[model samples]
Target: MKQSLLAARYFNTTAEEAMDGLIASATPRQYLISVQDGTSLRVRIWSEIGLEEAQMGELLDWLRGVQGDIRSIQSGSTNAHDHASVVEKWVAERHGIADLFLEQLDPTTSSKADMEPELSLGVLGGRTVMISTNTLMFSRLQEGVFGLSIAQRGSYLIEQLRRA
Candidate 1:
């Protein structure tokens, strides 16, 4: 099997800015959205992605209307391990979906290093973060399908968020 290299980029931003940047650049419907009891929003955003600043504000306002406390963006930890741990929990829990599709898959069978580092974006503590353990922003190593270098998608995402 061709092993993927670990790649990641860290940024200090809000979920709205990050999501806006991602949605504007991403393919249609590649992302998924889940709201937790109208208290928190969980988006399974695609790695490859933005909206305009004004539109973004409006969209966030709508979310806030439905999900209270959506604007009190708190700061998140910069520690990568903490982020990884959060991912681990998410996988293990699978939000109660594991029994349906991943019944045979054991979360313990995979180590953090062994898992395919997926692209993820979220507000850790308060700050927004974008990361992919197996994507390279810049590298001479093996290129991905469609000529993408390691974390090419994630690299594009961070840049877009910063610009937004």
Candidate 2:
């Protein structure tokens, strides 16, 4: 399969260091970084023709693999139960979609943003599935030190499939 790297970097470090760190850790075929307040980086590990292709639907199927319920943080102290249920329902419905990817953007250092979740959808194939939200969450966690940068390194597989 032809693979390209997608990466995003943040922080004061050089893009080379961040890219190297990601490649060294994950060893993926492709990499892409969405750096905030810094230059981004990308690398292609493999090249080939006629790789197995996928449509938007197929991408969605992969996303659905990690679908599940999420407990929401309490809202007000007096109506905590009601708010929790409401938030839980909202989250569940949001994830119920066929082809969606969600990432809780939380920076370890701290930031004003309330760690809002980032979501994306793959919509080419007939069988759409949601990608692993946990994976996206973890990726964001790793980039926490870099501020609010968004990284979609593992999504290369999905992107390749889409191209196919």
Candidate 3:
């Protein structure tokens, strides 16, 4: 068995900015990127708000630039739920189906613990792209700001399944 290798790193930006930058520079082969928030405690208190639709569109456009076809955007965090709804509306308006993956987390928990590192992937018309996120920290590692760790985990998994 070939062990999967990950090229993970700590980014020096807010989670949103890191996500935006990754989406902007995405490649069709790169579907998911893990994000970590690396802001000071004070900055985090002020930057908890999520991204807007227009901002999402800008990010989507960036993804499209890299041959990425995003069918939907899902949020697994409470703070990002509203933003996910907004993005879903935008995608629906554009005739794309959007969904929020918020159900995966327990809502009763505090936002801090609930908003751990999340995994989201870009799908092209129902066909999932090869990508996913692992268990990781978002706030502490990234300083409570937006941070991202991109790896080819999905592709590796897919390849392994194919061989099996």
Stretches of candidate 2 exceeding 4 Å from the true structure: 1-54, 69-136, 140-164
TM-score, prediction 3: 0.23
**For residues 38-68, what per-residue lDDT tens digits would candidate 3 score against the true structure?**
4221101111224355634544454342222
lDDT of each: 0.27, 0.27, 0.27
Predicted candidate 1 versus true structure: per-residue lDDT over 1-164, tens digit per residue? 13222222222223234455545554432212333455433233232323334533443453343222111111222233333333232222212111110001122435533433232323222222322223222111111111112322222221111124
Ranking by TM-score: 3, 1, 2
Please estimate how well model 3 matches the true structure, expressed as its whole-model Cα lDDT.
0.27
TM-score winner among the candidates? 3
lDDT of 2 at 83: 31
Provide the global lDDT of candidate 2 against the true structure: 0.27
TM-score, prediction 1: 0.19
Error of 2 at 126 (Å): 20
